[model samples]
Target: MVAAYRFKPVVVVLLLALLLLASLLSLALGPVAIPLDDTLRVLLQRMTAAELPADQVLIIEQIRMPRTLMGLLVGATLALTGAAMQGLFRNPLADPGLIGVSSGAALGAALVIVLGGTLLAQLPTAVLPYVTVMGAFLGGVATTWLVYRLGQSVQGTSVASMLLAGIAIAAISGAVIGLLSYLADDAMLRTLTFWNMGTLGGASYERVAVLALCCALVWWRLPRQASALNALLLGESEARHLGVDVERVKRELVLLTALGVGACVAVAGLIGFVGLVVPHLVRLLLGADHRRVLPASMLLGAGLLLLADVVARLVVSPAELPIGIITAVLGAPFFLALLLRAQRRGGV
Candidate 1:
């Protein structure tokens, strides 16, 4: 552990460098395929007001830049929340969806996609695009709140109860989403299917700003709970003995996770696996310390998502695969391997 601690700084630095390279690739790769130098030139010119080719400027500034930024924010938010959730649950396999926010958000987005034509017709055209985003965000928060309430009792918030409630809520939400999918028209069905798979294609400055704010709040606040999270790994009763406010920590972590994951789902649809996989990878290198895990997960998640997006773009050329599909392809095998390894070790 001491040796691992000594290498944590180096690991973080390497992850940061990888993230920087991934960001550059995200900006440069696509159907158009801007050269790395031109991508850098366009980025620098944006800051310094220097001249560049208008088309390159338009592509980088208007399209890829926002997409890249969104990828970073979404990836970091999901992975950070995942790390927090695992710490809260004292389980390595726990993820943000363990709280039901992802399913609730999906249900909400499904409603908007299937029903927006008539139900949202009265809304201004300018505001129509965001109705789904808002709905998903609100739905996620509402479900999390309901789960939190269900977990409450005379004994205070029970982590075991919350976990069960979250599973139940997620099931209910999934059922509702299935119903909506059944009712959707063919056009709506296609849209809903794509959205469910997730995309960064909807990236816009406005949406990125909203997500960035949520990510900022998460990044600022979650790390402050690092000590509490560390205590939590010792078990809640042990955490309380260590003077950690176990219930309050649980409440805050749940709320923060909802906000971060909700915003990502709202904007990018249902990209998965980042929250479940990235933190575990970080822990493999840096130990289980939240201080190292959280930050390292952030860097790695952002980088990995960006690389996945690059693959999504290149694999189909002019058309692109949904990023969620790419992540699922990558994560499922790793997840299975982890489970198998754990079983062999009698840890599962």
Candidate 2:
């Protein structure tokens, strides 16, 4: 038991090291290159003395830091949400955006972007991301509520009905987004399209900091819920017999899922498959115990997103592809492989 317990922290540390390596690589990457040596010196100098040459400091502070932080935060949040969703619904297939939360967030962002400067101009410039973030959060929460209500009968939450409702809501919201797109001008359309594709190019420290804090909160709290979720695997009645509060656990997981998903969608703009991919990947490697699974997913997710972002930067050179595109391209093949393996094993 002790050896088993020790394994998770060991794996977490290894994954964190890998994520750190990828983040350093991200700093080295761009249209104008900063050599690894100077990048390290710049990063170290800023950390040690908070002072450096203007150009070096600017590259490290103004440019690379925010982008790297955003990638980490968004990555961590996506993975955490995936873990929470799986726990809540008791299905490996469960995901945050799988229930229309992502579509709802995207719709909210589309509305803001389509409205032009006039819509959000009154807000202070410093708070624009926060405004958009709030809109996305509310949108996700609203959609989740709708899904729950529509899916619930006297039978409580039915996964099938919830999924069907999500599909229905997503379809309607997507059509609305299309209608808005049709009316968009060239610049607005370009902006909306790019945003939908997802990039962290416009990251700011303030936004990254906010997202980091949110992800941190979820990571800290969610892992503690693992034993309870593990108990849930035995069926609700059995879990309740084991002194687990089934409804309370469900409620908490749902709330935590919303918070984590909201923070990620707010910043990352609906990057799919991380939630689907990471938790399952970790489960395959670490076992289904959420204790090990959650932390492993967080680390793996961060590494995967950083690697994807790196590929996005290099894939087209001077023109960066959206990170979402890279993730989807990479993840679709992996998803298919997993599907086939599950079929062979008779697990699905």
- Report the Cα lDDT for residue 61, model 1: 90
Clashes of each: 0, 0
- The Cα local distance difference test for each model comes to 0.86, 0.78
TM-score of each: 0.90, 0.89
Clashing pairs in 2: none
Query: What is candidate 2's lDDT per residue for 1-348, written digit by digit as tens?
Result: 445455766767778898889888888877767788878887675444444456666777898788888888888778878887877777666678778877887777777767645767777878887777676777777788888788788866787788788889889878988887898889778767755788877788888877776677788788889999899877778898999988887767766677677777777776888888899877766678887788788888887898888888887888898998988887778778776886798854
Note each model's CA RMSD in angstroms: 2.8, 3.0
| lDDT, residue 121, candidate 1 | 70
Name the lDDT of candidate 2: 0.78
What residue runs in model 2 are displaced by over 4 Å at the alpha carbon? 1-10, 46-54, 115-117, 341-348
Q: How does model 2 score by TM-score?
A: 0.89
